[model samples]
Target: MVRERKYLGAETNAPVSIICNCCCKRCARKRQRRCLPPEIIFNILLHLPALVIRDVMRHVCREWNLMIRSPYFIHHHLRNSIGGIIIQPLFLAGKSTYVVMRRGCLEISEFDCGFAYAIRTSCNGLTLIPDSRDIYTLYVINPLMKQRTALPPFPHTVDIHSEFKLAFVEASMEYKVVNARGPKPLNPPKQIAMLTIGVDRVWRHIDVQHLPLTARTALTTFPLVTGGYVHWIGETFVLTLSAETETFCEFPMPQLERGFRKFLPMDGNLSVVYCSNELSRDVWEMDSETGEWTMLLSFDLKPLLHRFKDLFSNEKSVTYLGWLAVREVLVLSTICFQRHCIAYNVKTGEIQSFELGTDCSNTKPKVYNFVAHKNSLVCLEGGF
Candidate 1:
C-alpha cells in the first residue's frame, strides 16, 4: 500500500502539496505531486554552509530542526563543510584579542574567562583550555556556543610543570586530553594520564614502562592531530599517542640546524616546517602509516630577507605559525626586536603582513598558533 506525501512550511500549517505514487501510474495528471527520498534531501542540505544551516535553516520547520539536530546530519555537514581559521579565539591563552578569519573575512571578538587560563589545543572548532585557578583542571569549550564542560581533576598531582596534549579523534568521535607530568622537586608522577571527553571523567594512566617518556618542549607547544594520533614535538623525535588505543609511538624528525622546527596540521596529514638550510625553508609531509616524509615545497627567503632587512634582521631566522590552505598562503613570523608576521602566497609569491591590532604591544610577541577547523553543527551534549 502506498501513502500520500504532504508538505508543510513552518509559517503555514496547511499542506502545500500531496503526492500519491500508486495513483501516478493510474492517472498521468496525478503525477503533479512528487516525493523526494530522505537521502536526497540530506544531500541537498549538505551543500549549504554550516552557519546558514544553524542560524537560518533549522528554524524553517520542525522536520528540518530534527534533521539538523541529528548526529548523522551533523557529521555529514562537517565532512562537507569548508574549513576556516580562527586566530586566538581563546583569549584566556593570551592577553591579545581574538580574531577569527572565516570565509575570507576577519572578525574580531572578545573572550572573558573571568580567571587566568590557557588554551592547550583546538580540534573541530572545540578547544581544550586549562583553568589557572586549579592545578589540574581542564575544560572542553566551544567558544562560539558559549558552552563548556569541565573535566575532572587529575588523579595525581600536576603543577605548572606538567604538559597537556589534546586532540579530537574522527574515528572514535571523541576528544582526548593527556596530562604528561614532569619530574619536579616534589613527588613526581610516574605514569601519564589520559582522559576522553564525554566518556570518562577520570584519567586513565598509560603504561610507559617499556617506552620511556621524556620532556621535549613546554606545555606552550600544542600537539598536532593527524592520522588518528596526537603528535608532540619531542626532544629528538616526534611523540605520538593513538587516539583510540591510548598508546604511544616515536618517530624521528629530519635534522635541522640554526633554526627552530614547528609541526602543524595540513591537508589531513602532519606537516613539518623548518629551515632545511640557511637560505631556504622547506615544508614536509609525513605518512603516518609508513613513516615516510615527502617534501612538498621549498621557498627561498634570502631575497625577501634583503628587501626587508629591518624585519628580518637575521637571514636564516623564520618560523612557521600555520598554513592557510584555502588561500594558498603560509603564515610566517620573523625573529627581530618587534615580531613581524606575514602570509606568503606559495602560488603567486605575494606577501601581506597581518597586525594584531594597536593593543598587541602590551602582550608578549610570539607566533600565534592556528588550527584548521570547519564551522560545524556538532552539539556539546551529544559527545560528537
Candidate 2:
C-alpha cells in the first residue's frame, strides 16, 4: 500500500512494470478470441500434412467417412502417386478368356467411353484395337469398372476384302485406326484409310502415290520418347509414321527372318525377337538414335527342350512364344502343340515348365500372356 503519485498528465497507483514483446495489441486481442479447444486445435494441426490427414480422418471414425470418400481426395492421391494398372481381357486360343497385364496401376480417378473400340481414361488414358472387323457396331467394355461404350459406324466406305489395324498414340493425344483395303491401280497398288481421334469425320483415304507397297503390311503403333509413332511392315520393308506430323517415313529392318520376326518393347527399348528354327530364338535391339539393329541374346532350344521333354516333344515345333523381362532377366514362354506353356530364363538359363492342363471344366490353360507386377506374376490364358 503506497501513496498515489502524479507525473506529467498521468497518475500511477501501483508499482511500474515494463513488458517487452513483439506482438501488437490487436494481435493479442485476436488470439484470445480465436483460441480453440485442445482436441479441435490438434485436429486442425494434423491436416497440415496431406497423408496424415487422409490416414487419420479416413480411419478415425464414421463422422469423417464423407471426407475420405470425396472425389477430390481420390484425385489428389492418384495424381501425386505412381499410377494404376490396366489389364486386357482377351480370349486365348484355348477357348478361355484371360486378362493380360499391360502396365502398372494407373492413377485414374474416372474414365468414359466415346467409341466402342476404345475407352478413354480420365487422365488421358485410351486403348484402341484396330483390326476389329465390326467397327460400326463394335463395343468396348471395361471389366474393372463395368463400363461400356458403343461407337457409330465408320463413315468411310469399308472394303470388306482388306484387313485393318488400330493404335492409340499417347503423346499426340491421337487415336488412329488405319484400314488398308484392296490394292489400288497406278498408285503402287496400296489403299489406305485413317481416322483421327477428336475429329468428327470418317476415315479419309490416303493417296499412296509414292509410298512403297512393301511398307504397308502389318500396321502397328508404339510410344516413342519424343511422341508416339506407327510402324508398318510389308513383305521386307518397314515404315514408321509420326503421330505429331501425321506423315510416314521409311525405316529399315534387321534383315534377319524378316517374314516371321515379331516386334515388342523390352526394357524401355524397341526390340525384335526372331526365331531361326523351332529351337532357336534371337533378340535384336533397335537403335532409336541411329536406326541400327543390335543383337542382344541368342538362345539354343536344344538344352531347354531336352530338360523339359514332357512339355516339348519336338523342339522344331517350338513357335514364337511371348516374352517379358522381369528385373534384369528375360522370361520366354513357348507353347508346344498348344498343350503346355514352358518358361525360360535368359539370364541364369533356367527352364521351368507349367503344364497347360486339358481339363475342360477348368478352362484350357494356355499361357496367353504373363506380366510381373511388383512381386507377383499374373498370367493371361487364352487361345490366340
CA lDDT of 251 in candidate 2? Answer: 61
Ten residues in a row with the worst lDDT in model 1? Answer: 213-222
Model 1, range 1-384, lDDT digits (tens) per residue?
Answer: 533334433354534343333335557544324646668878889988766786788887788788888988887887776654445423433543443344444444454433355454556656666666764667777765556788887665655422565666778787787766644423334556788887886778775556653533322244566636667676667777777777666777766564656677774568876767777777778766445678778777766677677677675566566666532567766643223566676666766666654445456554443445555676787632
Each prediction's Cα lDDT score? 0.62, 0.43
Count of clashes, each model: 0, 17
Query: Can you write out model 2's per-residue Cα lDDT over 1-384, one digit (the tens) per residue?
Result: 334345422542434221112234667878768966645744453333333444465566554545444444433432333222221112332332121222321111222222323321112122332235564343323232233344345555444312333344545535555544534322333446666644635557676556654554334222222114445554554566554556777767777753457665442235676777766777787654345678888777788777866655775455543343322234334442444544456655765544443556656444343321111100111100
Per-model TM-score, in order, reads 0.73, 0.53
Clashing pairs in 1: none
Task: Tell me, by TM-score, which candidate is best.
Answer: 1
